[model samples]
Target chain A: MKKTELLFLKEDVDIPYNWAAGRYGSLFLTRLRDEGKFIGNRCPSCGKVYLPPRVVCGPCFTPPEEIVELGDTGTLVSYSVVNYPFIDPETGSRRPIPYTLGYIRLDGCDTYLSHFVDETDPAKLTPGLRVKAVFRPREERTGRLQDVLHFKIVD
Target chain B: MATKVAVVGIGMTENKSRWDLSLPGLYRLAYQRALEDCGLKSEDIDAVAFGHSPEYFEGVNHPEKWCGEAVGALNKPLFRVHTGGTVGGSVAIAAYYLVASGKFEVVLAISGNKLNETSSAQIGLSTVYDPIMGRQFAAGAPSAVAVQASKYYSQYGYNEDHGLMVAVKNRNNALKNPYAQLRIPDYTLEGARNTPMLCHPLRLADMCPTSDAACAMIFAAEHRVEAITDNPAWVLSAVAVNEGINYVDRDWSKPIGLRKAAELAYERAGIKDPRRELDVVEVYDAFSVQELIWYEGLKLCDWGEGGRLMESGATRMEGDIPVNPSGGTLCANSIGASAMFRKAEAALQVMGRAGEHQIPGVRRALGHGWGGGIQFHTIMIFGKDKP
Candidate 1:
């Protein structure tokens, strides 16, 4: 009789990546992280406003020229009150239920921005409800959408 | 019969890691250059055809939508086309068709990718293989092509020197191209052969570098061609062919799709003998061995004699039919845009606009794009005189 042992070989590979925010994305994100200020870019040719600024306006095919400060308060056009537990794709774990998501039309901006809302009750969430951005503290803020922790119903 | 069309403008950004510009911004730079080169405004472009590498490389899905305005396709019609390494070639063919069909008088075609955006483009390359049957063998592009080289060379009883000679020749030629990223000054055959081997037959020097680059070319109808440029590279013929990857009787050593495409392009262009008639050529040589393999596929030489052709120096700068006068994809490869540069460089040669890399007495030229596990092949022929 003969005895044999099975062996296994394992190796790990690491891949790192860096993403550029581009010219306009950096400006909006920088103002959010540095000053807790909301900003949007205005198209030079069409006067259209873009939040989380892009290099150019799609409809006009022209570069955005102006960076204007925007009010933190906005009207909630729509919202969803999620009551079921689900996996958070960004964290790879179960996310807490009863979270609220909303599309808010910010003041002086032509486009709508999506963000998390503090309210989870569908009864309290309504169209045209005024919401104000609540930002993270400067010490904890990174130049990303998460810098603004969430939006709270102000009216 | 389709109307005659010609290349009126060509724009290519420098090949390297461009960390500063966003993907859309990078695309804008190429389109802007093309517009300036042809003395045309955004309004002049009737439509836009765009292309880039897989979304897995940059994680930007629907890149054409994101870059529509960047290439001046705001209100104008625009569409995205992709075929892996031959994406640019497909876009070029689309533009030619758009103009030659009389649907558009002027068409703008832009293709490329920010390949450096990903940590490992090889990771994206690995996904192209069949998941159930072949994914376990998916190590990256170089590994697959190394086996391809091994199989082809084994069939011919030749060693790795032929591939190394191509690497050395392209590196020396890259010195003349300003947009080349890996230009090694006075690179020699000894230098190529001595480089560390990555796979069995492939070395570090044999493969192309990942780059963040874009290329744009404008195709104009014959009626509108003179208004755009005094010199235009007339489109003699263009063909694209693809084979199913079932591998029923597949042999990568002999690319059947490329052979068919080349045969059709030559037939349409009235070229009887390619090696003697064509003045110059730009074939997508993503790896050194591909240059030799494509030589056979392009009918520059017969099968099993590709190695012998390399030994004869018939594909060199001083050869009868000079290949890769702009250093080809071996010098600069941005995946999506790499193949278009071949077509653009060939057009540049015909238009006498290839700068220092231009081969002398180039009246007829050919551009080839090979891609997608050797399944997709595209051939475009260029001539100085209108057909």
Candidate 2:
């Protein structure tokens, strides 16, 4: 046993994920963050509203005729408490757990939009609870959901 | 009036990694087998109903258009069906309707999935939920199933052991299935229990493997059945139902779509007791816990008695009512092909062509598929003799 010697072996490989930066719908979120505005598409056929705007209206199968400006105030339709921690891409580490995720019905928009919530208590996050978007500093805006920071209790 | 319909032929490729075949190649394999099985060619097929999940998984848009020619749907009546994970079963029901409506003499129903084409199917599935509410919190399908399993445990005092039994039993059943992609020689309860957890309560072994496979079934109207095969699996009933995608009011623990779809299917099939009337069942069991949950939803057993059904060997190969004789999605899962496999397996059992895993004396069988956050459901009933 004393005479035995050990050796270590290692290998290196390049793992690449070639994702297009400005392809498809990536530009849509960038504009929203830069402009500090809420834009949604209006269906001409059925007059239904689409938030974050889709190219075609699902019910009518027609393209959106016009863009409408939506307000930050909305109601929380439903929510869940995420107890599991997730890794943050920017920091390359896990974030705090027990964050609230909810579906918010934006003002003047027919369809509800999903977003993150600041409140952690499950009881406080219920359907029809009024809330407002809390945007990050204008200098820090990057045309993403993080630009809005997170939704906080309006009342 | 709805015309009567029957499954004249059914064929499925041997489930495997299938590294050599493309999506179109996989479809042709099953399509050719089904045509030969029915003693007919592509010209005999009046219409075709294609089933596949999202295009993102295959990294292509409108996959039916890509594989339409191979399925022999070129310039013919072709309809694409999508219902998340349950697309396969939904395609069968769609084909049944074409024959039942008296609009087509025979319809070719086909579905397949090539998960091997993608690096991570779980990453693709994460985008299926409501982008705002569930998207950010998405843990993929396994985690979502784990949430439901956790809720089931909290509501009923079921431990992790119940899920372990289901994993062991289904893996064991796959040994007899020649087409099964994953076949474990000797799987024990303790081994299943010790497998590493992906999401809480759901271990690595508790989930289905992603495979490239295809399943096809030929449905014919009453008059055309005799021309195809004498041992036709008569379609007693077929039903597709959907619930609200964002129904914030409903309970997530027990899916409402399953209940509504089961009720309508049982009504049309004139089934008073599914456990006694149905000889075999092919349920959507992408996750091990789902099979147990479906046992109660399908009324094979009362609510909360699904664990007992597995433990008592009621759903075993030789049990009172064998479930998933084809090893189910657990053994071979091509998401889009899974639901179709369920329908094809049920049809095969009724036709007495299930090979080693065949349930003896199976007369009537039940097939089910559900998908999209449990919002979509499809159910079909098949019998050996005419209804």
Best by lDDT: 1
DockQ, computed on Cα atoms, for candidate 2: 0.08
Model number with the top DockQ: 2
Worst 10 residues of 2 chain B by lDDT: B244-253
Task: Give the lDDT of residue B372 in candidate 1.
Answer: 87
- Per-residue lDDT for A111-146 in model 1, tens only? 666577898665586566899999999999988777
Give fnat of each prediction, in order.
0.00, 0.05
Q: Residue B13 in model 2: shift from native, Å?
A: 1.3
TM-score of each: 0.71, 0.77
How far is B284's C-alpha from truth in model 1 (Å)?
A: 0.6
